[model samples]
Target: MDLSELLDDLIRFWPVDVDDVSLIGHSMGGLVLRSAGHHGYEAAHEWTGKAKTYVSLGTPHSGAPLENLAHQASAILAARPETNAFGRLLRRRSGGIRDLRAGSLVDSDWQGRDPDGLAAAMAAEVPLLPGVDHYWVSATLTRDPKHPLSRVIGDGLVLHHSAGGRNSTRHIGFTEDNGLHLGRANHFNLLNDARIAAKLVDWVG
Candidate 1:
């Protein structure tokens, strides 16, 4: 649906003769980029063939733990009449916010699932583009990435592991070599920090 619409718009408006296509997105935008690429690849869209490099900055590919917590909290509140209103309000978060719960990038990932349910099964894995080089940048608030807090509350929002697209169920095919991890930084730092800019230069400049 939405992904298909994006793919169609991309095909319609983009130049046709570009030889190499490099894509970069931050936060939820990264997931959108992946969805677009995946959608194009699945449908044999011509642009998919020109895609060469993709980079995601602070994307919660494995899902955002904060959203999961909020979902759980909403359920608890909904169980009591005293807090039902609050629960309903929380559940009213936009679809884009809900999609962050599992980094869902395609229709099958959420089509038939109960919107209020927080089941792990709702997080279906979407395959990566076959020939595209995918890269990721993740950060943590602590000076040391190995700090216990970094692992649990990375960048104050997304977990370090999730940003890197790794979870107990699967690794989203990113290699250590293709990822960049920054410490003593928050999620937004991935957007314009000098280190990140340098890395981008090395990777695609």
Candidate 2:
């Protein structure tokens, strides 16, 4: 099933009350949370009203270039008989992976298209839920924030700009105070960083 459908099922069967609930999404989980709250989705309004805070950790909010590259690589490999099997395996990505191509938060973002093709032309900008305090955390491999490696291999997966919700065409516009950058950290570390955990506690509290 698609991420949206899975999210819908999750929300539908939620046992606890959603009022005042705060969501913390790491990596692709962040995208799922955003998708659940996108206006294009029916559940968006319901969750948005109850959600107090939205925190994303090392999420590819502007799409993951790595995945895009992988798609291209897979296609090329699949064309060759020698690596055809391996390439075919790579090409057979889950619906969730396809959705990540453009950080799609709505069904329409990837409803009917070539899963292997470039990201679909976005129909509209998906805005952040109003009244919900949105937070972003990004990590960098370099110790210095200004290091060239920091920009190129941000967290070794997602770029700092993308994770921090900085987009050129569309604005997620999370306040400076709501965003944090950690140096000498990789993508996986964001999940267990004591500093990040503390911030989440503080924010949720």
Candidate 3:
């Protein structure tokens, strides 16, 4: 479902004080949280006003290079009949995967656009929820955060910079103190890392 539909479900099932709420999402889930928050904020939803924290783990705030490469590869393969079948397979990726190309969150990000088109630029910047603490966690596969390998092969799937929510032209406005970087770890490691758990406790426990 789209962000609007997901927001509708959240509104329907929310059963706590609208004055206080914490949102935590991992990977693509993080993008969903951002999208939902944006939708709620724009519509003046009660929950948006009270959202205290938003933590995104291993979210590709900037587009994922792997997906971008795959998107390009799919198109190139589709151009030739000899590899059209393989290209079709790659092109079969879900809308969610396509969204990852540029971390798209809202309908306008992809609305009226060609899904298979090579252009994967963000339609607009989705601002963070005002007055909410937005934190992000990133991981790298090298022991040192500054290592060149870590910079390029972050978490084996996402680039460290992308996970941190900053691109050349856009910044998610996360404060330095609100972010975490774990070296020698992969993306999934964010799910069960001790430091992350402790950080969560400190942030919202």
Candidate 4:
């Protein structure tokens, strides 16, 4: 769904004002913050007493391999400027995105284009505001039991390196019992899992 439309719906259904809100988002939701000029932060500032903490689950701080498919699709779409959803999705978010370059993950092209949410976020992500703590949860997905990721590090969909802040991060296993469970949790589980809801409340409190 469109970001604006989603937010509009949130405004209607969510009873909390900005100051009372604790904005939590996942992959595209984080990108939405950047695209919409960090509406999460703004909402937190307006409703909550502090800038909302952001934790990105499976959000590619560097960039995602999915972009490669998007770039290929854009080519198929006649190389229109930000006309494609995937391409436009990364651009509209933040600025100074370096992860979307050719061979980076998605686009895999050296060619350049206008600012994107991915780029914008990379540039402005540093020196996070007070009370605005951001965490990254990475996943490594693979069917191979002997896969290096399965053997070493990952949540399944995201690599260990992909989790955390752009310049800093904390890698947490979704499961507290094992760091190398070699299993993948759905993206939302990293944030809203049954085990972690209390933690989230504590963090937001």
- Give the per-residue lDDT of model 1 (tens digit) for 1-205: 4664565567668766566778899999998889888777778776678778899999999889888888898988988999999999899988888889888887677787888986664666788888888899999999877799898899988888887888888788888899998989998878789998999998887
- The residue pairs in collision within model 3 are none
Sort by TM-score, best first: 1, 3, 2, 4
TM-score of structure candidate 4: 0.48
RMSD (Cα, Å) of candidate 3?
Answer: 2.2
In TM-score terms, candidate 1 sits at 0.92
Predicted structure with the largest TM-score when compared to the true one: 1
lDDT of 2 by residue, 43-148 (tens): 5534455668989999888877687778888888888999999898998888778666667776676567766664543524677867789999989898775688
TM-score against native, each model: 0.92, 0.82, 0.90, 0.48
* Better lDDT candidate (2, 4): 2
User: How far out, in Å, is residue 101 in model 3?
Assistant: 0.7
Comparing 1 and 3 by TM-score, which wins?
1
- Alpha-carbon shift of residue 139 in model 1 (angstroms): 0.3
Q: What is residue 73's positional error in candidate 4, in angstroms?
A: 7.3
Local accuracy of candidate 3 as per-residue lDDT tens digits, 1-205: 3554555557658885344778999999998898888887877776677678899999998878888889999999999999999999999999888889888887777777888887646636888889888899999999876799987778988888888888778787777789999988998999999999999997876
Q: Which lDDT values do the candidates have, in the order given?
A: 0.84, 0.76, 0.84, 0.43
Q: Which window of ten consecutive residues has the lowest lDDT sum in model 1?
A: 1-10
- lDDT for model 1, on a 0 to 1 scale? 0.84
User: What digit string (tens of lDDT, one per residue) describes model 4 on residues 16-79?
Assistant: 6544334555665554443342443344423223346655555544444455344344444444
Query: What's the CA RMSD for each of the models?
Result: 1.9, 3.4, 2.2, 8.9
